[model samples]
Target chain A: MTTVISPPESPAGSPAPRASRGFTFPTRFLPVIATIALFIAMFGVGSFRYEGFSSPQTLLSVLVDNSHLIVLAVGMTFVILTGGIDLSVGSVVALSTMIAAETLRAGWAAPLVIVTVLLTGSVLGLLMGLVIHYFEIQPFIVTLAGMFLARGLCYVISLESIPIKNETFTSFASGTIEIGDYFITPSVIVALVVLVIAAVVLHMTRFGRTVYAVGGSEQSALLMGLAVARTKVGVYVISGFCSALAGLLFSIYTLSGYNLGAVGMELDAIAAVVIGGTLLTGGSGLVLGSAVGVLVLGLIQSFISFDGTLSSWWTKITIGVLLLVFVLIQRLFTRRTT
Target chain B: MRDLGLRFVRHNLFWPTLALVLLLLLNLTKTPDFFSLRLQDGHLYGSLIDILRNSAPTLLIALGMTLVIATRGIDLSVGAVAAISGAVACTYMAGSPDESTAGRAVIGMTMAVAVAVLLGVWNGFLVSVLGIQPIIATLVLMTAGRGLAMLITDGQITTVNNSLFAKVSTGFVLGLPIAILIALAVFAITAVLTRRTALGMLIEAVGINPEASRLAGVRARTITWTVYVFVAFCAGIAGLMIASNTSAADANAAGLFIELDAILAVVIGGTSLAGGRFSLTGTLIGAMFIQTLATTIPTMGIPAETNYLFKAVVVIVVCLLQSPKARAVLSVRRSSPLLTKGSAA
Candidate 1:
């Protein structure tokens, strides 16, 4: 049984024109361009309306605050490109944080803890991929089960938060590289490094092309001799690894691991990915676009904060509205193309 | 006799019923009084009764969910819709000077349901009209509905101390909880409404193949839109019931994760997520199974915090068992030896 990767069929037997060119870039770049435009518009509004919002330090603070989200969205972009989703990422993040904090508290070496958590994340992703691939279960259900398993594991580790006291972790949290008036933390640096690697891999690697092919049409991918199964599984593994890395950064940023941390973060990652111009049906997207999506979300939060009279829940409402608009845009484009 | 028994075992409802029975038996083993019901005044009291009462909200939501799923659409926003319903109802009631009146309660409930219906229409429009994917379409509300709820409550847990409102959930009717009675009424109406008309068949056809069904003059858009509205209405009532049960509506926590439970109930009831033929009876059994599981977890001495782990394992097992791959292996093993005997004939 095919699960979660069913592309919207063309209206009739006649397929839509697959090759299309816009004025400059390909037609597929429309959504990503729109996302960038939205980000810029929001940034302009913030700069115009709020006194200090346009300052580089304010922009840097947005990055610092949402570095973990940026990493999560990058991972999510990969999965969505394969016409799959990884709902377990948020739970995996919480589980990773709990494991890191507990291990650090037990005086384990920081490097060892980091490696173990990353491996654990990859293994968890591998398990889910096996079940989803071999069993032909829906990715939604499989990742949902993974979500529960990870969240439950978090509770089993400790119902309460565990504070990290390791010197290395503390130093990492405190360490920052200055650039003029703005400073960038280790977490931000890690996030940027991950973004660069993801962009390169997704844009330049054969495996990346395979992911797009599989998402475009699994049957065609198989006929073309691409390793569809491996590509599908690999995307989830990447997501898991990224979630764990993000979790480690989060724990460092907070200096504690709480079971409640990162609740609904998977949704945020999804929102960022979609807002960044990734299609939920998969096939076409950009990692850099997802990074822009993260910034848009961070900017929304920053704007809400700047508007002291507004409730924080407005951030959620705005994201929801933006997600709807993006989805609508996607639908219109698909309708027009098909 | 053997043939009859085998057919029964092979029936779709068999496994879920057996699971529910096993859960009840486990409860009985722990506390013999689990099965014993007693009449107190006009109402019944027992573990079984409690399960029935507690499962009312889920059952109501699942009743609507089964229909939605049958049409190959999922309503992920049910929980959030429920939250919004509760927030609207409670805030309306709380704002009233005389909140205890039956008329005010009716007005509040009507307003909440009206809003929910509108939300449902929006979901339907996105899916059927706009041709957006159901998961993503419903997700818009699933993400923002709670925020809307928080806005309605002004980011506070709105509480109402209305006797009439409280009675909607806690009061008894003919020796049973009103909530249970309402759920049963809804179930009966749904069963009659689907089976007694062509609605059920059309819905199934649409779910099986929307384009083919549309070409067959099934009015797929209308059917899809109706089910979304119905599910939202049910969620609204459930939201009201839950809010009345606590006499408070906490937007953040109200109806949280309930959509998952409702979906699980539908799955457990043997409804395929891929959509096609659906069983409302099976959904009822599945809802009961989940409620019993919830009740059993705490009674079995599992710590409250780690209960979700056990639940996760059980859900996986149930889902795996229903998976075609698992069934294929089991059926292959069972029929392999019999194949030779059959071929000899």
Candidate 2:
């Protein structure tokens, strides 16, 4: 977590820093700006077309419904930033819920079960990171194997859905903070806290800068004396931890742990990351951008329900289109940066 | 003579072949007649044949995947492409009579492959023309292809009762399953196309270093584009075989996770994910190994769900053995597979 680049901060009056201030601003922020604009346009269309769409609760509900996704996207943002992809997040989420449910059924305390689930995910991720590093294997293949391992472990725990009926677990799941008609679940709060922490770590700390550096070019990062291997490994661990946390949030929402739950949720998280103006090739994206991407997806669902005519599959197709546009945008912009 | 014999023993396929044998042996403890083969209705029948039968679709996809992987690109959308193909074919057949004739089935399949080919072109465009990352580029189809399939099928599992259509899976030729024959034919053709021609070397060159290959007058872009199209074509046929097997196209479930299986098969066959230097023969063994494992799980009376767990273990073990670090730890003095095969990579 130590910053390698924070030492010898450029003095405030350094002519180099002052000269380029805001010079690269337009192209750099274009995708995020475009994402925010599209989100607003989509929200505007929904509010105008549907009754009760403009209410405060609609946005609040979007946050609550997609809290797990937001958390997953936050984790995905970290991995994708380092030019690596973790195909295992969705499966890890499933494994976490399976473990949490089974342990609780076996009379384990709430705190004990939660810690166990989180530890299981991190350990699995750590092993994968080790393999990826030591073997000099591609991140794509290593994570694909991890995906299989985690999902298989879920089946090993239980093939059937296990319901969580523990008093504390269910209570926390149903608990909500309110402002009259506007309300939020504890899961949403947790997701937001994760986002803020990730943002700070990514932007305000040296570790975060190192993540971007690694993603930009690992060879250059190594030449610059950064811990490329550690940063690469650390991102996967963070992703695993986030996936487990998202799994907890998801369990609260559904209160049931099914083996097949979140089968393609990894795609959703990756889609959110891409849509939030983050480049798929990595090194240039924002955690907050990913949060907006989640909302864009959530709003599409809201739009579908409001119309009552569009099928659920439209969400996938629409997101794919949006992702295409954003990718093209990022491609064009990154061409400029490089 | 002894040196040549040692080199054969040190071949890339040595371990995977052994692993397949070991897995087959594991089945014997439970099935006792695991290796038994009999002629039934003038057709091959046995656990061994069944393994081949079950793995046909995967073998076909893996054949395509091997080439794509050789080009330093991957097609994660193959499963979705398979689903779409099945949906298209079944929906076409069901649009006709329930007892559709051979022409109906052929036409439906042709249309299905056509659409799949077009989808491949889109993927090729994104990757080769637009300069998008392969993983992200094909991911667009991976996400939308299912929805497209559902749209094609009206979100229904289109069922066709055409006998000729079902024959793709159920029919036999010379006492062998037709599906396996098709897969084998494709495998042979791919070998000839890649190895017999300069195409294979060109692909390896592109994979090893795209910029250098492009500068050396290699048509890197076209080769990349063609490889993707070939994989989608393979996926389309595999999807049709799957639909023919069940006589239905469940857009929701058809070809689900087959991409993972194909990728695993390719890896298990001694093809590195880093791309270049592929072995079709190894893929054949790997696909059979996976299919055998599926049967082995049920025969052992354990929960069938642990199949994924077993697969994960096999993948890890295979990868570890391939790793130079593991090789050093185990003190195997064999040349590194990467160096021995394609040092240019």
Candidate 3:
């Protein structure tokens, strides 16, 4: 957050103190300010039109319905922070969901089913990381291939939608703890828990520091003796695990798995991560910022649905615009900070 | 002669050709008619020709993409640009239903190409002037360009009734399909433009080190902008060819994953993702390789639904071979045998 200004390399006749007085502001507070401004604008618009837009139930529902996406965005923030992207998350979600639903249909135990799904996602991510690291291939191409392979595997498992008949998933999905007239879904709790854990891991752990260091500069990180390849590979593995977890949550929420599910969800996650003030170039972002971004996007969708006139295509357009705006802001911020 | 043979063995073409041979040998074992060529309706038809025809659009796009990639920049909007061009051409042709054949077709083609060039210029301005990242800059158009295309056609597929338009894809010229001829023409133009001029040198220099090139007065910004615009224009031409082939312009589906296909072709053609080098001839071969693999999969009785998977595998393998480590291992394998024999003797 501290801005250290260097004196301009000019003749001594030029202004002295003024040259050193560069504009200084805290970087960490920018997202918070933007979040507050967006919240105020949304509240004002909702109050002007919708009757129950400010109601606790409506807000809770918005958060609950989009919790799975929020989880995906959280994971994507980590990957994007390291200046890498995971385009396979959407397909991985579908594949993982398919695996879980198929396991449940085959009468596998719920605990084992969950572990298998998570492991499958991690293994896939590990393979991608190994290929990318050992072979020195670009992450984009590797992940793109991952996208196709995962989606194809989903179809190979079953082209038809597989319904989850397990009572465990149903209960976890539908059951909610009530607080007077407002209720909190289990998925929302999971999303919040994951966000908190991610924040802790990113800010407090050695591996997190290595991740930031790697993204900041791979050469510098390597020179600093950081495990660059391991860190890079680890982040992707974490992303894969997070995607698998999101898939499990999605199946719980939907009670079915279809190969066609989550076809374009990776773009949404990328948009969310970008809008959260994360640099696509890598090395600076907050998991909590991504959570806020997911909420902002969810609110936009909620407002659009409330209006009842706008088509769903507007969602893609709005996200595109927001992505552009945030990217411009990040560019300006980086220019100033450096 | 010995030196020439060693040079040939060491060239990158040697390995790709070896791979191609292996693939062909594998295919011949399963399907004896895989290499059979025949003439039908005054046109040469065979698996090879079919692959070349099918890969025409991708080859054209990849030719442009190779230049863009050589500058260490990517244009994700190529697919969208193609879609927009298709929409413009189809919409214009549909609107001027009663106009003279030559006038309407010529006007429509010109308009489509102009629009694509304009869009490319816009992208170049953002990337080179505004100093935006190539991916983010192209993404803006990638998202909006599709909408603009849909808006032009009212989100409907427009089928063309123009014979001249269809000829671009279906007609034959001098015993060769017009599509193949167009592809060949594009390849020749690009090859001459890059190899016979200083333009290619300047592009490679700028890509290797932009700031250094600027210090050396290479006009890096202008070069970068020019390549993106050129790439977009090429994509536009490809769009027209695809739409003409299908005889229907479905803006949404016309070029959905073409960007990926183009990127794959460029990578397979031995271009480095990190920039500073390129190969137009290699891209042409790569395009044909992809098209042949795609066609062969279905022909060999594999389920059609697995095409995406098969394509993914091929791309992964090709990419792996291009990786620095893979090349290192290959060289080591070729040399280690000599070292072992010398020690044993």
Candidate 4:
């Protein structure tokens, strides 16, 4: 009868396989439904309370401002989908900015510097990946070491912020695409492209499904003759690459590479991914949800700033409460399915 | 007997102990008087004493974290709880007209500790009853905790002018810092509680394999629940000491990265993140090693900011050595007949 299954995708949290099931939930429907509803409800409240809140410009601005975070959440989604995590993203972003700023100042060509930064990121991810897979150290600890290494390397480069005044970088950051009365930054375009690419790879490609299968049951995936090692290691590489890109965008946005940039941003990315209906335990989630998650976070900040009288920390509280509610919902569905 | 010698070499405490000793020796090289203690105004003081005092909070948090890790769990909310307790205490004392009153100090501390205990219960309920990942569960509080703390102090840094309350961190008992005394008492009590009761074994069993332990009649849930509560309490107390040190509670920054330090200490002390076997002594050495390293860079004439760089190096070296693959290769080289001959020497 195709009753809800547990721990395996006989009814895995993916929305793909449950097309014909009418009696039960689309299964992935619960969390996804909850997230979308919450976003709408919050958006409605904002539009009702604050003037011009529902304007196209404010929505566009949300995407423009959080473009860096959007990219980060995408990377975090990949890692978490595999029941793994990458805590080094924030520090790597900081390192990226530092490297970009210093190299740009040293008269290096922007394109060459960009390639070097992304390559450096991939290499860092590769090293951590190799250590995790071969040495079998926990991803948490290894990424933590990566975090410390990246941050420490940032300090080694320079103890203070290095302003990015390079012509190409600044112009790119300043340039915006306009549509009628609304405008969006190049950073948002880049973030959306990355998101689209990630969604395709996760949904369409063999390697992508392998990620889900591996998360569903590594043993079964291995037994099915999948290249578990490469896929596992590759997810981290993707994360590292994304973090570096985010860093490049951040440098362009802030026009400087401060040593303390993006501190505790990993938590923010994680919170967004989780709140967007991505299962923390792996094997379930949507990339677009992570995008919405970032928007929700950005909206929370907007809500706080809009009120003016509201203390800034209230944003943190709302995020926390949302996290609590969504996480509980996740538990309910998982338990009932069991 | 020869096997026993190898066991000592393989002991989890071996590397951390050596690191601590070497760091101290390095400090000695810089200033011959580094270890020299003095009786100043009826209290002992020295670089060594300063380290003990500085690391007390980390050590206390690590002590609690050790138990939590032993149960296959982690508490990311410690930093937030630290900030919260400190905020609550400082806010209470600041609101009082007679801020210097010892009674007010006592009441504030009680309230702070009680609140901390409640937070721990919340963590316990989440982990035990809700079946959530410890990291994700505590992360909820970790994210909101500073906000709660800031809310308590009305989003302002709470500065209290209470001499009695400040004594919690600053006062001396038997010529030792009271903070260290409190940490040591907690450590001793934890040691006794774990080692002297069946509780320790139960915790290990659950950590090693929760399902198997459950099948074997262990209350794995209770163990997990209690450990989280305990760790939160420890973090809360650390917060109080931290606040007293500055006589102010900057909710956002008070215990900002201390959870990472405490977790790092626990990991460095040879407590595996995988959970199962744990060593409190290793945690002690780990905390000491970290505190010493933080000071060592400046003393060695290196920029103090590069401490993280050096720490990254040390963490990598330590983790590599502990990796099963690395150990397997080492054992293979040792047991090889030809390779063992002169190389083993």
Best by DockQ: 4
lDDT of 2 at B34: 82
- Candidate 2 residue-wise lDDT, B1-345, digit = tens: 999989988999998998889888988987788899999889989888888888999999999899888888999999999999999999998998644888989999999999999998999999999999988898899998898999889888889999988989888999999999999999999899888999989998888888889999999999999989999999999999999999999988999999999999999999988886788899999998889888889888888888888888888898888877888756534767676557445
Scoring only the A-chain of each prediction against the true A-chain gives TM-scores of 0.93, 0.93, 0.91, 0.93
Instruction: Give the 10-residue window scoring lowest on summed lDDT in candidate 4 chain A.
Output: A1-10
Deviation in Å, model 1, residue B216 alpha carbon: 0.7
DockQ of each: 0.66, 0.66, 0.49, 0.69
Compose the digit string of candidate 3's lDDT tens values, residues B301-329: 87655666876787788787878798777
Ranking by DockQ: 4, 2, 1, 3
Off by over 4 Å in 3: A1-25, A46-52, A177-179, B1-3, B95-102, B329-345
**TM-scores across all candidates?**
0.95, 0.94, 0.90, 0.95
Evaluate model 3 with DockQ and give the value.
0.49
* Candidate 1 colliding pairs: none
Which of the two candidates, 2 or 3, achieves a greater lDDT against the reference? 2
True contacts kept of each: 0.56, 0.63, 0.40, 0.68
lDDT of candidate 4 over B90-136, digit per residue (tens): 99989999988999999999899889989999999998889999889
C-alpha-based local distance difference test score of model 3: 0.83
Model 1 stretches with alpha carbons more than 4 Å out: A1-17, A20-24, B332-345
Q: After superposition, how far is residue A75 of candidate 4 from its true place, in Å?
A: 0.7
Global Cα lDDT for candidate 1:
0.89
Candidate 2 overall lDDT versus native: 0.89
Model 3 preserves the real interface contacts to a fraction of 0.40
Candidate-wise lDDT, in order: 0.89, 0.89, 0.83, 0.89
lDDT of 3 by residue, A1-338 (tens): 23344566565664333225352234655764676577568867886798778787867887798898889998898888888889899999999899999999999999999999999999999998888888888888899899889988887888789999898998897799797989989999999999999999998999998888887777778878999999999989989999999999889888998888997688778877777877888888788778888877888888888888775556656766777778778878776655
